[model samples]
Structure formats: structure tokens, C-alpha cells
Target: MLKVHEIFSSIQGESSHAGWPCSFLRLSGCNLACSWCDTLHAGDSFAGMSVADAAAALAALGLPLVEITGGEPLLAPETPHLVTTLADAGCTVLVETNGSLDISRLDPRAVAVMDVKCPGSGMEGRNDYANLDRLRPRDEVKFVLVDRADYDFAREIAARVWTRQMVHFSPVPGRLDAAELAAWMVADRVRARLSLQLHKYIWSPDARGV
Candidate 1:
């Protein structure tokens, strides 16, 4: 069984799949308390359901793409099974994980969008750098930058590790301006994409269920 916070259909808000209709299964609970986390409301409250039920819920949404996210989905032991279930059922699955946990165990068929916590997030120490070695070309590395220092930090990592996979640098909403971040990326000629939180623009930043 898995502890589920909410299941809803929305546009893929980030990463290479942005703007596509997708189903999101947000699981509850997290191990790290990042300073700028937007989903604090999902911390503890949840409803438990078997993997079969959760798969049914997402499949009912009729979207070909699905993302299993969380307060930190990797914290839940059943997540790998859930990912496999969804993929076997013919849905494209994405797991958005806080980079602290080991992602090597995830179903190879599901794309893993791993977030390497930047210094600005206040949880940088929690990042498992070993996860970098485990990333497949289809996976993504994300850095949510809050300032220039964070950008530099992400650039350094991308320089050393990024190859066929995409490296995304997203400015923390309201903290760093998107245009400024884009300029810095261009000036440095960094091999990374600028990701904006699309749902926040389509709906209010705090709007629920997209």
C-alpha cells in the first residue's frame, strides 16, 4: 500500500515534458525540510491505497503521461512497485524525486527527474551525489536556484556531470527573475535548460489540482 496525498490531472509543469496533459500522484511525507518547499501542506495527511488502486486512479484520468511525486516519493518503500505498475499498464511514468535518496532501484522504464538540492534550498547536504552515477540518459537533473551562488553551484555540477541527459536550472519563484537567470545561462554558455513552473502561470501559484 502507498500513502497518497492527492491524485489529479494537470499539465506537466516542468522538465522536458512541460505543457503535456499528465496525471500526478502526490504521495505524502518527506525527510528533508527545504526552506522553499511549496508542498508543506502535503507533509503528513494522506489516504492509504494499494498499488492496484492507485494505478486505477491514474489510468482513469486518461492521460498517457503520469508523474509520481511527493513530499518525497522515494521515502515510500512501495514507490518502485507503483512505478512499475503504472508503466506495465501502458502509461509513461515520471518520478520527481528529491535527490537525497537512492534512485537506482526505480523501474528503468520510468523517467527519473532528480533534483540536486542547491545551497539556496538549505538542504544541499542531503543530496546523494552517488545518484549522479546512476542517472540514465533519459533522466534529468534539476537545480532550483535562489540566487547567483546557486546558479554557479548548478553550473559547476553540470560542467562535470551532465552529458546526454538534460540539466535544468529553475529560479525559485519570486526570488530570482527568469530573464536574469536566462541571461546568466547564455553568458556562460551552460548546457542546461531554463525551466519555469508553468502551472503557476496558468493558475495562481497556490492553486490546487492545477
Candidate 2:
């Protein structure tokens, strides 16, 4: 069984999957403490669920897409098996992982939306650079930028490993202006998708289940 924070159906908020109808399984606990964490309330366990039960719950939501997110979902030992099970069942699985852990273990059929923490997140040093070599044709890399320095950091990484189709550049809400981010991307000709938190804009930013 894995520690579960919450499970809900919502629009895919971030990444290239944005706006797609998606079910979420947010696991509890994290290995790193980001300064601008939005889901601090999810850090504690809400319940415990087995891998099969969790997969059934997501499938019952009747969405084409499903995400296994965190509080660092990779921290759960059962997650890789869960991914494999879901993929075998013909469900589209998206593993939203903080890039501090080994993502190379996930099934090839599943898409891994890996978050590469920026300097503003205060967890930059924890990034697993080796994961860059592990990215597949279908996987995505994300950078949640907070300031100009963070933008520069993201740009450099994008240049070095800009092979994928979906390099997401998202700004921290109430911190960095989206317009500024758009301008910077345009000015520098940076190749990445500008991802705004769609769920936050659709509902209250503080809302638990989208």
C-alpha cells in the first residue's frame, strides 16, 4: 500500500496535457521542501491505498488520461508497478515526478512529466542530472520559474537538452508575471511551452480538489 493524499478528477492543469480531462492520484509525503509549495496541506497522509485499488479508482473516473502525482510520487516504492499495471490495462498514465529521483524505472508506455526544480524552489541542488539522459521521446521536462535568474537557468538546460517536444516553463503564481515570462521566451527564442496553472485559474487557488 502507498500513502495517499487525495484522488480526484480534474482538468490537466500543467504541461502539454493541459485542459485534457484527467484523474489525479496525489500521493502523500515528499523528499524535498520547496519554498513555494502550494500543496502544503497534502504533505500529511489522508489515507493509505494499495496499487490495484488506486488504479481501479482512477479508471472509475472514466477519463482517457490519469496522473500519479505527489508529494514526490517517486518516493513510493509501489509507483513503478502501478504505472506498469495501468499501462497494461490500456490506460494513458502520466507520472508527475519531482526530478530528484530515478525516473528511468517507469514503464515506456507511460509519460513522465518530470519537474526540474529551479533555484527559486530552493531545491535546485537536489536535481538528478542523469535523468536528462533517461528522457524518452514521449517524456516531458518542466521548470517552475520564479524570477529572471530562474528563467536563465531553465534556458540553459533547455539548450543543453532541448530534444523533447514538451519543455514546460511555468511561473510561480503571484511571484513572476506571466507576461514577463512570455516576453523573455520570445526575446531569447527559447523553445518551451508556457504553462499556466489552469486549475488554479478555473477555481480558487486554495481549493483542494479540482
Clashes of each: 0, 0
> What are the runs in model 1 whose C-alpha is more than 4 Å off?
none
lDDT of each: 0.93, 0.91
lDDT of 2 by residue, 38-107 (tens): 8788798669889989888888989879899989989999999999998998888999998999998899
Candidate 1: global Cα-lDDT? 0.93
lDDT of model 2 at position 190: 87
Q: Which tens-of-lDDT digit does each residue in 119-208 have in candidate 1? A: 999999999999999998789999999999999999998876666788999998989999999999999999999999999999999998
TM-score of each: 0.98, 0.98
What does the lDDT read for residue 152 in candidate 2?
97
- Top candidate by lDDT: 1
Q: What C-alpha RMSD separates each model from the true structure?
A: 0.7, 0.9
